[model samples]
Target: MEGRKLFAGARLRNLRQAENLTQRQFAERLGISTSYVNQLENNQRPLSAGVILALVDGFGVDIARFAADDGDRIVNDLHEALSDPIFAERRPSRQDLKIAITNTPDFAHAFLTLQRAYQAAKDRMASLDDALQHEQIDALPLPYEEVRDFFNYANNYIDWLDRGAEALATEIGLEGGNHLKLGTERLRGTHGMSVVFERGTMDPDIYRIHDPGAGRLLVNADAPRATQSFQIWQQIALAEEHDAIERILDEARFRSREARSIARIGLANYFAGAAMLPYGRFLSAARGLRHDIELLAERFGASLEQVAHRLSTLQRPGARGVPFFFLRVDRAGTITKRHSATRLQFARFGGACPLWGVHQAFERPGEIVRQLAETPDGERYISIARTITKRGTGFRAPIRRYAIALGCPVAHAPETVYSDGLAIDRAEDYDLIGSSCRICERRRCPQRSVPPIHGQISVDARVRRVVPFEIS
Candidate 1:
């Protein structure tokens, strides 16, 4: 196989098929003639990386997966792949590279887009690695709760999944009963297809694919059976009943199309997690365990992070449990993940302020840190964060790791074990905390690093404000 164009044609073809648009139809979507689409797909012509950008930007495929031998690595791989021998003679000049990346409409999709995340993490890690005097620092403080907040918006999907698995463990143990394999067969019998696990993937995340003509369904096989089962159920739900998911995406005051797309994907992921961890039973078990995340993990065969995450998602229309916000952030204040189903407005831009407790979850691996934060305005909430490791459980696995966090308003304290002897401050009678230093107006905030939004103008050397910021 010619190396330089490795998977480019295949990716474009896959995108066309996935969109259910004929080559002609998809070409129309890209505003390119079918001939151009043909040339690209058949390898008669190569798609500059810009075109690849258009595929993701114009359509909704996760870009991380699109340009991969598998979806696991990052942007650097895409850059390296293009430098392969296939393009030896037509070598993309530095000028070509610059224009394609910056000027090409295809690549501009990401340019105008705003996810500084992966880059931010890389920068922060590099900084920390130097400061720690190690190539890869063993640990940097993480904002696990901020990651929780990412999921909180969708009702704590992590916990929904964890709790769901736990309940299944209780009702029917997680020990391999050949049930997972057998279950897939049963669904295949009903749906007239079976799961497909493609090794050396371009996209590592689990997914389901259907072949209409052959009446076959393909599912990524890397996940645990529980995860596979959950994926199957999720695909079914969205395919059959996507009204609610569509509604949320359509309805939210999303700031950008990218955010909306991310939200839709997030919402679908949430729904699937919910179906797997049906809210009622999981919620009851959580309370039953007195919020012991470890016990919940064992019972459900889920990661500790998973159980803690679901605890925050106990929100349903009538059965509304707790109003919680979850977050996952690193020491540099970059929020890697978050969810919010409550009025808990998360900071949309900027890294979260360093003063929050979620950032500390990294320092205490496998240990839970509980904090009571009272906003400058007098609102209080309880936050809990912990480190959860993610890596290959078997030989020679890739290392993907991070921490997670959870927080809910004080009103919901009685329902959680975190309430045990937790100190609540007055004036500060609540856990004095704010979502972001940039937006928060808390003038006397001790936790404040940079003063709140208007704090800079308010400070006078003579009339220095108590919070280290000035107020007129």
Candidate 2:
């Protein structure tokens, strides 16, 4: 008996074409024969569990993607096979099906075989359900947050950035990057500046451009807090070591032209932050200031967001500081930029957790609010959030709304303004809002559109809502 194959072979082929890599090159990376890679792409072969894992670990393919459309078909068929139309029908939940894929693929394979036979018997049933309209559903993309969360812990890159930022700050009076000016001899004679902007014409994405004439580049004021500080950091990175950054980003199998371009720019910025906020020096200052953002900003001549953004980038190696992540969001709860040097996961498609102080800061206007949160792993983090509103160049122009969140490990919580005995252990009762639909676990959330991955919900006719149906 045969069933629908993963179509993964087809998707791989598409990705390969977009990347412009030959089968041999792809095969070489996997340490497999070109023939094997060819056969797999042509659908003449099925992806083994080990091969799937290898693709995820080595090539950065999201394992959830492989389990999605390809695995779903198999699961649907298994359920149909296990069902008994005449009597005591047994139906497996999607969770049970997922466990089979994650922990026991061998069992999954056996179930698929049984499903094929059962489908043969149910052929009559398929014809009877004549109201069916769409038989072929386009496969949905993988859960992006899950994949990003995986990478968030892969290395100590964040610590390096934090340490590097501090180290450079200590050596260069903590105002190393601030001295740069646009289109000046101070830049040309020693450090120079360049100007660049985002693609659109209306809103400003005006950022610092790299200038060959000037010794140093100028950062853009129009960028978000993370991007602004990062550009400042990038300027610093150019003046220092360049090898490590080139090495790390070189390994990516970027999805498209856009991804590669963003990755290039993003990695360079990461290196720059690392260069400025060198671990040891920055951590010392952080402890000295007790992570007081305003004081740090004044001491370093950085903006409020600048110091906070740096506070989160402190991931060093053996002599590590508290791992922290930072994010900037607007009034509509749109996250413009985020960078993590910690275990906390950032939503790729949506905003952030609503119960956290970051979202609440919008209500306080210019005031800073300290809060705490717990992740799925039960690790607690202390977060300080505030609203930073910048006026337009003219009264005619619209004012911009923004929020900054700086967070650190719970052990360092007491030092930060966030850990004020807020009982952030578990807010199970509060609504889980501001997250990508793909990775969120809050089935009872009033904001979720699509149910979270593997979640099952039963809508009762008895209830209606002011918000979306809550998932648990």
Candidate 3:
């Protein structure tokens, strides 16, 4: 069999642009004709072995990665996006999608971005309509959603903030030490902020309160040790890494001030987690422990949620860990927190598929529920979910509960402790799950709350199945 031809026009053009060279200049450096370079950049010709060698030798491009198309994800996202009811009349075939992505990847990406923006706007409008029945209000982008997209597009890893937090952690000896005490000392000595633990009757919902004017920080004594430590580190982030966080926000270009403000809190929280876990040490420990959440939490003095979230952010350039997606959902199936470093994206608007193990986690609280899940796109993942409860200070106070899930591609399953004794190779063992009901194409899902938006359903009087109608 002959080797597959590599038409990496986008990659080739990007590589040339990165070197600040024109097509002619790039061709000259590669010892190729300008016409040939043009043809290659325009996808009119495939990259030859000689050209690949020249790229490796001259531009230091990894041929394996440079020649790779990364279009599978784009295709999957396009399929989901086109599955919207708006495109019900005309859906492209899988082959058509592959050709589109391969030929015009940038356009494909822009389309996906537009689809996301449209979905976000639709959700926001619906929310505003629900809240204001008679009043005329302008529907604007939701701050939380904007911030979520920011982190999601960034692959849940803010490199500058992560590195800065890691350096600060190292400077302050946060690893293998009393993190809370160290963080408190750092706050007091560096920022001249007084730390006060309120043992008295504080608000049940309040965990940490900071008074910049008074230069004092108040913490609830009844809160967990992990919460206390995290809050302290968050303060340190605001105090020390304010410039770095501001730089990130400036580049992010949030639509509204509310989004920017929310992102500030999110970046602070990210810094706290990064500082507490400190990328290198956490990654090493996680690998050593086979990515065990409980053991890693214990080792880092972090909570399960923190550890799981940190695991998703381990997407450093060279030294990367297993790409995992972390998610948190409330009892009502609302996604409170989500970040995916993998291709398995969560539904942006509607909640995840009810069949997901994360939803089942609520049934068996405290017990880790493991699942081998396959998405509609045929990607398999090993998901582990457990319910977490945040208790109020008193018995009469309210308690907040949520289920958090962390998972990666099944290829990385062996690196996780949750995969023990599992049927990794059994195709029948994998549960079929979809991104959402609106985008899911599965016709036989018994738990489907609604029909797929893009398809026509026939409701015959005499026909009854697991679903109410047949999808066409």
Candidate 4:
């Protein structure tokens, strides 16, 4: 930072545009001349320390994040898109990509959007028989992807909902009380919704059924107490904080009604998680416990997945947590849920990397597996993975299986209990991993499923190696 000049003109300009401020207005707010702002926005001059501090003070920007490489994901996505066979003959150079992103990031985003649509179309084409049989050929983005991207861009923290849930937690005296009892009491008192546990009478697939007409909430008596408490809190969210959730939905402006509805449930779930583990108390406990997930889960009466997901959402403005990334992957390697407050970005189009410890968690269930991993960009992280098994009520009932991973950058590893005896300074101990096989730039990896799409390769019939071809 002392000698390295950061030309973040595109980011600065995008920030100004988002705030709807003109160059003169932005300059005045920063106590700088319009010409200087112009030069900075145009990349004619690098951002000075004074300018950076001024921007931070005036706009409440996170100085640490402001200088971060926010466009790294965009650049990576662009590389993946350009690797398509259609662009094989005219792919832009890596330096050209950096310049384009620095000068015109919006165009890069638009190109990525188009490329995603094209890829979706190609995938649909591959299933032409099913598409024709079901008459379901459509190029619109998947609702799940749209919602996932929305949460990703929002940094997985919805301020209004979080505050509302925190307030509700305090109001209901959940700090030291049993969450299930308190939540049920609040539902009955505030919404006139009495809880009734239906043992064998409840439908197997339905965890909870809200009966507005009867003023009753029928919950599966056999479900885990934590899950029942979660359902109760979810109802509280819809009943108590409906307006806040709706306001966020209105602002999100999802492309389809299905996406909006899915997002609606997602927001409710978020509220449930936040309310169950209120922010201030949770953050204090996390720091005091050095972020011991097992201990935190036991204290909060939350499942491992819930605790991990809640930990990732502790991104309040002045009271940030360890900046962990939470991810869930199914047995077949599909990423079902992902959110990263750290620099590592999950692959956009596929499963977690085959080499990632999250995938290995499936092989060893019920145990925490820790790994020191380095991405292709040289950033190292300390991740812990474990399998989450959802048991069915009956022996014949279907069981659900998944694995979850939570991690943070190596710089913050000292603050986590999981990093107790790990060799943090040993570079050779870190396992080199990547976002996805198709976009990974690593030249050699025994676990690679496919060659990097953006690199040249040499294949020889007489050659035998870990992989069929050598990447150049």
Q: What's the count of clashing pairs in each model shown?
A: 46, 33, 0, 0
- Candidate 2 per-residue lDDT over residues 1-472, each given as its tens digit: 0133443566567557766789998787667889988988766777775667667777777444333332433443344334343322445676787546544444665554444444443553566555335353212212232123223433324333344555555555544345333113222433444334333332453556665655345454545444555565565565553564445445444334454555555555666545445556567888887788887666654568766666665543335466677889887777776767654556544566666788889888788787655654456667778988765344465677799988776677777654555654555522233335545554455545566544445665678864345554
lDDT of 1 by residue, 137-234 (tens): 32221333222323432344333233443454345332323335543554566556556654445145435566667765666565555556656655
lDDT of each: 0.56, 0.56, 0.86, 0.85
Tell me the tens digit of each residue's lDDT in model 3 across 1-472. Answer: 0267889988788788889999999999999999999999888999898998899899877554355445655676688788887786788998999888887877986787677778766766777867666664435456787788777767788777888899988987887458889988998998899999987577867889999999999998888899998998888899888898898899778879999999999999999999899999999999999999999898888899999999998888667899999999999999999988888887767898999999999999999999999998789999999999998666687889999999999999999989999998999999999989887878788888888888788899897887888878
Clashing pairs in 4: none
- Per-candidate TM equals 0.54, 0.56, 0.83, 0.85
**For this target, which candidate reaches the highest TM-score against the unseen true structure?**
4
Please give the lDDT score for candidate 3. 0.86
Q: Once model 4 is optimally superposed onto the true structure by TM-score, how far is the C-alpha of residue 122 displaced, in angstroms?
A: 0.7
Candidate 3 residue-wise lDDT at 170: 91
* Model 2 lDDT at residue 262: 58
Q: What is the descending TM-score order?
A: 4, 3, 2, 1
Provide the lDDT at 281 for model 2: 56
lDDT of 4 by residue, 317-411 (tens): 66788889999999999999999888788888878888889988988999999999999989999999999987658887678899999999999
